[model samples]
Target: MTELSHEGERLQKVLAAAGVASRRVSEQLIAAGRVTVNGVVVTELGSRVDPLVDKVAVDGSAVQLDPDKRYVMLNKPTGVLSSMSDERGRPDLRAFTAEYPERLFNVGRLDSDTSGLLLLTNDGELAHVLAHPSFGVTKTYIATVTGTATPATMRRLEAGLELDDGPIAADRARVVGEPSRGRSIVEVTLHSGRNRIVRRMLDAVGLPVVELVRRQFGPLHLGTLGVGRTRDLTRVELGQLLTLSREPGRPRSGIGAPDAAGTAMDDDESDSE
Candidate 1:
């Protein structure tokens, strides 16, 4: 076991300050062997860690020790640009960021005419991993299209299709319900970060999107959040996202250790728009 130096803050104190728990409970968790620092379980309550450098986990979930890092989820409304600022003075995220002191930016993007989940954060590393096409984090969308999307169509989406940009396919796709009137609701999930990828994919499948809304991004979901409102991410949501942001095979250790287990909802509402 590596000895903890006295140079950094005590592990329990860091955990408590990170909103994991009260210092006393943090101490209890540490002593109970529920906490690990960089893959090694740390049972010593007095063990110290640099919040900026040392990775800490509780019960297998990565913890965010940096207090200044903010993760926000916004249910963006249609016609709002994904950018913090629009050069043409169009509706943008300034209305949302103006509510927080943090200079946050969107993790990826939502089309100006499309709406649903949008993540805004000041954590550059996380934002980069999520927004970069190479990282391949999946996003789920509920799109209202022109006609009923058959199982064959969904299979075609899953099987793959060619776009003007390149070949692409959904990680998963399905028809949400029986077609109502002239429209059908479809749910599509894909990891490509290509611009307007969802819209393009649906068009290629002969189901032009009439309305599109992203219901999920990685582990975060829109979940009954009203359109145009923003809220801070729950501890569980943050932990899951931080875990996703890490490179493959990094320790799945924890923070966000609540007094009780935290629950996150999976929103699959087809009518998210």
Candidate 2:
């Protein structure tokens, strides 16, 4: 067994960089004695290892440094779970991503009922940063509500609403077009990632959401990506996202807003109850 060396990276970090898990989870695995370094079980959180020289294995499976990182965007369809697998064996992204060799997880979640752009990647650090609320990464959604949005309601949405969980507010909210009869299209933007936040916020204001679709996340926009399809983010798109995640409160440009007519209801899939 190789002795802990100051020159090498920490064991948890090495595990995270190897895509085993996030740094915190990796520490738990180490504490559980599931990780072995140089054929010796390492249960210490402070242990270090040289990736090039030390053989690391988790659950007796050798961990290899994954050099080919993937960043993919999936137009998540309604009725499909956001998770990689469902305990009840319901549909999930696994069916869509089965062909890809690299194991990837969603950066943030979109409820099974909602659909839009969802990012998947094997880069744990980037995923952590993007998902953290402190980063202030903006998410844009177009909601089809059952009632027309009045100017007063728009003001209230911007000011903030007291949901069951806590106080929440949208950064921006606007009516997409003239309300026809009872239904209206609303555009909302906010940095909060609370579960079903968009739906909850509208519900707080008496406007129940009929359909919701996330059009943009940070600097990446779901431009013309058909439902149930997945594609790689462009190099420029990935670079901008990384920059946005690293530096919070930095102003980003050219994040296109959702078209007024292209609301979630436009999709062919039926909304889940």
Candidate 3:
């Protein structure tokens, strides 16, 4: 765990800046008596703090500032939801986190049944910024379809299809390697994180997706990473990812951004849970 910031600030303010959550959420922790300064529960709304030297605990654990951020890349397995703890008690990414001492959360979600590269981190603000829809950190996937999707299918995907809700499209769609008999391995890269957008798009065209495995997200790629295995994010990789837009208080600008009526990032963004 990193040391708490010694900088002059309120305990709650430091926690929020450390990415524990937003400032408003931090206040709630204080109200619930979850925050403590120097070993005493602090219910005061305006308690001052010095993260650098004072010990602050939230729910009995220290909230420290880590000068060096930690980033993890995991080849998430199918059937486990993307969460810190699962009420259903089903298997999750926590299986490989024994060595990680700091509290962590998913960078983005992968569907319970979709297996692919997943990011986990202790830095709250980085996760929030990366998960923000405006970033559109493009992701790539290799999907097996139920039926043959010829050059025409490729064009259809490129042209984008209309769904019951709205139009869905792929940023780049190409056949991987040579198409096998009755099966075509296709590589799809998209910036929009819509719910099952790939499957839905093909389904609408009568080429339902059978198996989907993500190969890349932003600058991170699965490559030969074995399924269910986890790895550390290289400094270079993390640096590249940080270049993504983290525009605050507004949705990302583009056709990929959801409609005016929409509330959250589109559907494809979730593959884990």
Instruction: Name the best candidate (by lDDT).
Output: 1
Cα lDDT tens digits for candidate 1, 164-242: 8789889999999899998999999988867678888999989999999899888898999999999999999998988
Clash count in backbone of candidate 2: 0
Residue-wise lDDT of candidate 3 within 1-273, one digit each (tens)?
Answer: 233443477766778886667889999998898877766778776677765455566655455544445778888887876665666787766786667886556766777777788887766556655666666678888888766767677777888888887987888887766667677778888877667777777778777777888889888988788988888876456545644432234233332322222112333546334
TM per candidate: 0.88, 0.67, 0.67
Cα error, residue 140 of model 3, in Å, equals 0.6
The residue-by-residue lDDT of candidate 2 on 1-273, one tens digit each, is 346677788999998997778999999999998988866899988888877566677776666544576889999998887767665887777877787898777776777888998888776556666665555678889999999798789899999998888999999999898888799999999988676778888989989998889899888999999999999877567656654554535333322222221111111122232
Q: For each candidate, what is the lDDT? A: 0.80, 0.75, 0.68
Pick by TM-score: 1 or 3, better one: 1
Better of 1 and 2 by TM-score: 1
Name the regions of candidate 1 deviating beyond 4 angstroms: 249-273
* Global Cα lDDT for candidate 2: 0.75
TM-score attained by model 2: 0.67
Clashing pairs in 1: 57-253, 57-254, 58-254, 61-253, 61-254
The lDDT ranking, best first, is: 1, 2, 3
RMSD of each: 7.5, 13.5, 12.6
lDDT of 2 at 156: 98
